[model samples]
Target chain A: MLKIFSTQLAGIFQNIEKSSEEAVEDAARLLAQSLVSDGTVYFHGTDEMMAVAYEGVTGPNAIPSSHFYDEKTALTAMDTVIVSARFAACEKSAAIAGAAREAGTRTIFIGAAEKGTDLDSLPYDVVLDTKAVRGLIPQDDGTRTALPSAICGLYVYQALHITVSEYLEEI
Target chain B: MLKIFSTQLAGIFQNIEKSSEEAVEDAARLLAQSLVSDGTVYFHGTDEMMAVAYEGVTGPNAIPSSHFYDEKTALTAMDTVIVSARFAACEKSAAIAGAAREAGTRTIFIGAAEKGTDLDSLPYDVVLDTKAVRGLIPQDDGTRTALPSAICGLYVYQALHITVSEYLEEI
Candidate 1:
């Protein structure tokens, strides 16, 4: 109960990004730059995507600094976008990201580029390649869950924060 | 970024009515309960309160199974609730929560409370009070941006999730 006052910083630091740490870091840098440039970042995800929007899982100091979804909160012309991607099969996000573009915000999609897929043409300025964990996917009460993918996506989000901070010209 | 997800978890873990750790265990339990009940937890937050609507700082694993904001989503009658409080001054939320209460969903508020404040007396079932970290006197940000009260509240929001999960008796 005390964490309502204390534990957030510790909890955020607890789960480290294993394999995809670098990609996440680079993504963070890009995001930070956009933020520093006065561009509010928008995070879009579908199905399990909305999950990322509720909290800023990868902000400096373990804070949920920026993750806009509300139309009222939408960034104006100068905003940048950062989105989480699992597989191309996550087509539900098309409308979501597309709508963001329509709102006059830029777009960036982060996910794995499954070999034959043509990822180079997307509107994203940076593509952070995060690979899936080879073996340990999460399953709760006999129900298989997409925890690994979701988990890694979050890490990339944080890494992007770092990268953004690193690239920030002033500080 | 990644912290948003962890922040969700951190908020849960931090806001438990029980001991900090026990609260996390309980919140995690509640998350499992939410899923098993076929209920999609509803998230409503605005401004700085977006932490409730999205992710937190990176590292920890705090991904929710599902959430709500869209009116068209499958949310209905007596599901669950998550709210953020800013000085307890809400107008729109009053109407929304009123309608939601009529629907029978349980509501939870993350805010500051005086020692005698009776959260149980309210329509909501739970209230995670961060004691609203107050400065001896209100100060301007130019003086310093350390509103420990708000930060504490954020941490509480981060903790409650863990407690709910722990309560549900699942992973």
Candidate 2:
């Protein structure tokens, strides 16, 4: 029983390593640097995905900085937009995408890759495909349940923030 | 200008001091220790309050010996329900609350005052009522906007967890 338990502990650590794929973290740094270098970072959240954004934004942990939203320099120059999967029903996301296009601002969507998706293809300077990371998980009850989505989403947030911090060093 | 800024910070700190309440924390501590000491602790969040829950629950940070919703325990002693205001519209929260009640478990609603709210007729568990936490700030342009609700909400969680940890010492 003792041997089994110890091996089980080691197995968990190995599984965690297998579960982690970080192709998007380095890309996220470029996106952050690009936005900060230019002007503003516009975050688009659908439903509760706002929590991920609230962490990166300055002032009031929940609400994004109004100053960043209001300033013209932030909007026109380096403003990078991040869209979340919760945008399935959120029309506001599409509006932001359209407005960004009209204004020539850069946009990134952490969403699906269905063919011909105009928003999906918008030269996403950094796309941390969270769903693809989820796909890499072994077929199991936990993955099908809320565990994978919940865990991976938080992991993506950490990866992106690390990339953003590195991006700041470049500037 | 600097003096004025110092005064604002002082006021914010004072506001938090005045509003800090702790009876709910005491109650929750006893509650968590009682259940967790035995076997498991179950949570059912209501409404938008689900956001508050996803963090301390099945997420990576919180390690539960076993997932509560995954199976049924035959002990019949497990009971403790955490309700939030946002649960009113959330079916998932409602279902969990219902399950706990049906299983002959105790329930606690960490939200605004209800009819049976005793010990302290507080709206929210001490911190929210006393915390400067998430008030709206007037913009220079004439509009008003909220800071961050989670920042304050997390403060409440911290206070509650501290008390709960102490309660565990007894069990």
Candidate 3:
């Protein structure tokens, strides 16, 4: 079962790499610029996607967005904020992205892009679609298990980290 | 870079599935028993690894171990606690495992098993080694990037979730 899941995940990663490589690189470059300029880089997510925020904040030059209400006071125009949600239309995620945009900071949303939703209309400067595949594995018992969004979100974050590190080196 | 990381992760996942399959199955059975007996299952971790706790608790029949200091009041002998760390020998992780042991509950420790560490000495009923590879990728700047433990830890949790779900089906 794990081998099957791993194979599926490997394919998912390949798809993301092929389609979202430029977006990941561009986001990383922007984040690297913010870090180099002494501007804050904030990470925000709710529920399982919070794993991405935790991973981001623990790394260099990133802060955890614990208090989104205080973003107006804390975030500056030069800063960057990255928000992840299992579903791109998550209310809190949208609110955080809106707040970041209001604060004149760059906002990036990373999550599954849903059709006919406000996800595409959100005030994000950049959006990296996780392309999370749901119900990939069907059990014999007539139930299906969905892939956890945190895994895909973390995969993207890891790629962004590597790209950011590389950009930092060049700058 | 993301493709490279994903390929490495796929191999790591395969290695863990091959080596720790029985351990994962056993741990899942134990967890299932605890849940069936109306015992609480708690998850705890610090830093980025806290994501594991978050993931675990959000699932069925699990609680987040937010306050480890009050384990005596909150946990009983019938309960089970799972703790995750980047290194199995983390001091806080060991302390929590000890406290859970003192509380007379079943304890599990999941993480990378470092050489020369007292991971075997921890008071855990079960130890699921993530087998996270260190220095998996070498960068152009002559520095090696270690595989993120959170990714491996989450992978283990996902497997455990699937196993536990299957076990729940049988009972």
Candidate 4:
């Protein structure tokens, strides 16, 4: 079962890499600008997606000048914010992205937005789709098993973190 | 670069699937016993590894009886606790596992324990190694990049969750 799951997960990862590479680079550039200007990079991950926020703000290779976004966070035009959630239409994540846009901050949204979803109208400056909207395995009752939304979110977070690190190194 | 990361991460996932399948099953069975007996299953994830804890406790498919482990959590022999960290030698995770063992509660450890590390002596009912101690990509300066410890931890958590769900369905 794990072997099958691994194969399916690899496909999910490949899909994200193929589709979201450019978006990741673009988000990195936006975040790099914040780092260059001494502006903080904030991460706001909704619910279980907070795993990505914790990685960006406090992981071993955490982005320099990063913070976990909170209600009291004061954003500025120079700052950048990354909002993550299981789905692109997450109201909580969209709220943060909207608020950041109002403050003139560059915003990035990382989540899976199915076709025809409201993601098309989100206020984020960049959207990196994780493409992990379903489970990997099927069950007897027709339901799915192994919904790894947080894992997918973290994979995208790793890519963004690496791209931002490369940008900072080039500077 | 993201493609390379995706490939390397797939390898990491495969490694965990190949080597830790039995351990995951054993841990799931242990956890299932607690669920069947009306004992709460606790997840204690250290630092960034808390992503796994959150997923197990409150994600879309949360365990039947699960909670986030805290210092104030009281354990009984009937209950089960799973401790996770980036490294097998994490002092904090070891502390929780130690306390759980002292209380006679079944314990499981999930993390990477490099060869010759003290992982051999960990007092836990089961240990599932994630094998994600190092970063995936190499840089021009000889240092590695894109360490996805939390991601790997979440993968293992997903596998365990699926196995436990299977057991519950069978019962």
- On the 0 to 100 scale, the lDDT of residue A115 in model 3 is 74
Per-residue error (Å), model 4, residue B71: 1.3
Residue by residue across A38-78, what tens digits does model 3's lDDT show? Answer: 88887877777777887787632133222232344578887
At residue A138, candidate 3 shows an lDDT of 70
Which stretches of model 2 miss by more than 4 angstroms?
Answer: A1-50, A53-171, B1-21, B36-39, B45-48, B58-77, B86-99, B111-134, B140-143
Superior candidate under DockQ, 3 versus 4: 4
What are the candidates' C-alpha RMSDs? 8.5, 14.0, 3.0, 1.4
Deviation from native of the Cα of residue A51 in model 2, angstroms: 3.6
Worst 10 residues of 4 chain B by lDDT: B111-120
> For residues B1-171, what per-residue lDDT tens digits would candidate 3 score against the true structure?
666677788888888888888888888887887888888788887677776776776522133232232345577887888888877878898888788888788888888888787656888888888877474577778876846688888888888877887788888
Return the candidate ranking by DockQ, descending. 4, 3, 1, 2
Provide the TM-score for each candidate, comma-separated.
Answer: 0.49, 0.40, 0.91, 0.96
Give the candidate order by descending lDDT: 4, 3, 1, 2
DockQ of each two-chain model: 0.16, 0.05, 0.51, 0.70
Native contacts present in candidate 3, fraction: 0.45
Find the 10 residues in a row with the least total lDDT in model 3 chain B: B59-68
Off by over 4 Å in 4: none
Query: Which 10 successive residues of model 1 chain A have the least lDDT summed?
Result: A3-12
Q: Residue B119 error for model 2, in Å?
A: 11
- lDDT of model 2, residue A62: 25
**Model 3 clash pairs?**
none
lDDT of 2 by residue, B110-157 (tens): 432223335232222221231323324444578543332333333344
lDDT of each: 0.48, 0.42, 0.75, 0.86
